[model samples]
Target: MTSENTIKNQLPDAISARVRSAKLSEGVATLVMDATGLARPQAEALEADLRGALEGAEGVSEVRVAMMADKVKRPIIAVGSGKGGVGKSTLTANLAVSLARAGYKVGVVDADIYGPSQPTLLDPSGQKPKARDKQLIAVDSEFGVKLLSTGHMIEPGKAIAWRGPMTGGALTQMMEADWGDTELLLIDLPPGTGDIQLTMIQKFKPDGAVVVSTPQDLSLIDAARAMDLFRQAHVPIIGLVENMAGYMCPHCGEISDPFGTGGAQAAAGQLEETFLGRIPLAMEIRVSSDTGQPLAAGDTPQGQAFAGIARKVSDWLKAKGSHG
Candidate 1:
């Protein structure tokens, strides 16, 4: 007769390494296997291998396997800008979608407490998050990204009017929410260096930051300030993104630089930071965002721009050995 000890000892090396706990009783063998850092297919394969190894064991008439994945500390990336309206939220939304499309489990926290917009941009269904055991569950969006935002907690068009501590508490709640199997979190920070930014730096401590700006001098100056804050905190500046770099006329197909071109790249060069890529000011992008459909969900030209940026970010993560 096969005892629990006998079954565990007989497990193949590969299967033994992943089996966390096992039991055998009344001709039934049950197993709990660790599936950490494994994709769905890999986890499934592991289960299959384990069942094959034990199904024919003496005194085992049935096999039950439960694949359990240990919670991992996912890397958090902050996406911030010097001021509002430079398309920081838009970039964050598309970047999350782009990363998800590239086979990553991504989540977004709309940390712009006073002006949360991720729920609007990623999930137009206006669904509120369900809570379990006092922890907030992240809302699922059709774009394959998870989201949590104050917008989901409040009525539409309601002013937040929160003080510094209140806003910090709100950020904390979202940051510590239940984000199962999320490999990366892109935090859409409120613009400028303020209470919320300071709280995030001192508390959550993001792994890196992506500063956004237009190609204009004013936006670049503010962007530099934002970068300086991250530098002071010793958080790596992943790179800079130039949003609204140029616009193409729908009528004549003429390319124009309304915010002035190449300024962000030049600024990056001078500051010794990487200029990840640029996103043009396209009408399609605006329309898609307004309609709660991320341009990066498709393969349009605008979508391709976001995809290119995501690739660069992924490369940076891989180089740093931070990508799992």
Candidate 2:
């Protein structure tokens, strides 16, 4: 007879740690294992491994394993800007790629209904997401980030002339998609405080917001309004990112402030928010984005800039998790 104690002791440390309970009776082994934080494939592999480990045990003819995992609430981060042409979408794409590079399962929701550009930035292959059981699946990008965008749903270059309620409905559909095991979602909100923004705030409240702007007075003013929207809705401001802060001449290697410098940092200080970092107005960034290869996927200085910002955001997330 195989005793329960003997069976428990025989489990590998990795397996035993997850085993909440184990029993052997009548030539059968039963196990209750916690699969917390594991994705479906991982949990399935664990089950197979557990069965394999027990199959050869004395007096064990059958193995039954029950896997239980706590439901994980995925955090949503809104990447917003007060006005268009500030590189908010580009920043969102890079941030998602950088976070994915840092071992996070991240997803991007291109909530810019009128101007869905993530498909072009992240999934240049133009692969449309499939639907399963009426739930839209996220399309996988080469950079390890999953994506759901209005660009995928509609034909290429088609203009979206949707009313507030209609656009809001579309936002809801993307937000409630079947994102498997995605721990974080970066929503690239449309520019300005419009219907989509309000729908995002009221329907699926984000855990935090990252406001993007150029380091110019005009852009900073709009960025402030965007920040105020999130503040009014009680969404925490993760920080501010100064995009297009400076331009570097590729040939001459001279640096110049095309949009002026440090305006966003000053604005962040005035608003009592963290200044995440700046992304230079680099042609490399623009080219990489246009080609659907995020610069953050590389290790160049420009890539490192996005990576640095991602590190700060990751640190903030860790701190938030620790507090909870």
Over 9-91, each residue of candidate 1 has an lDDT whose tens digit, in order, gives 87888889888888888888988899997755688888988888888888789999999987677889999999999999999
Give the Å shift of residue 57 in candidate 1.
12
Top lDDT prediction, candidate number: 1
Backbone clashes counted, model 1: 0
Which segments of candidate 2 are over 4 A away from where they belong? Answer: 1-69, 322-324
**Steric clash pairs (candidate 2):** none
Tell me the whole-model lDDT of each prediction, alpha carbons only: 0.92, 0.91
After TM-score superposition, the amount by which residue 39's alpha carbon in candidate 2 deviates from its true location, in angstroms, is 3.8
Candidates in order, TM-scores: namely 0.85, 0.84
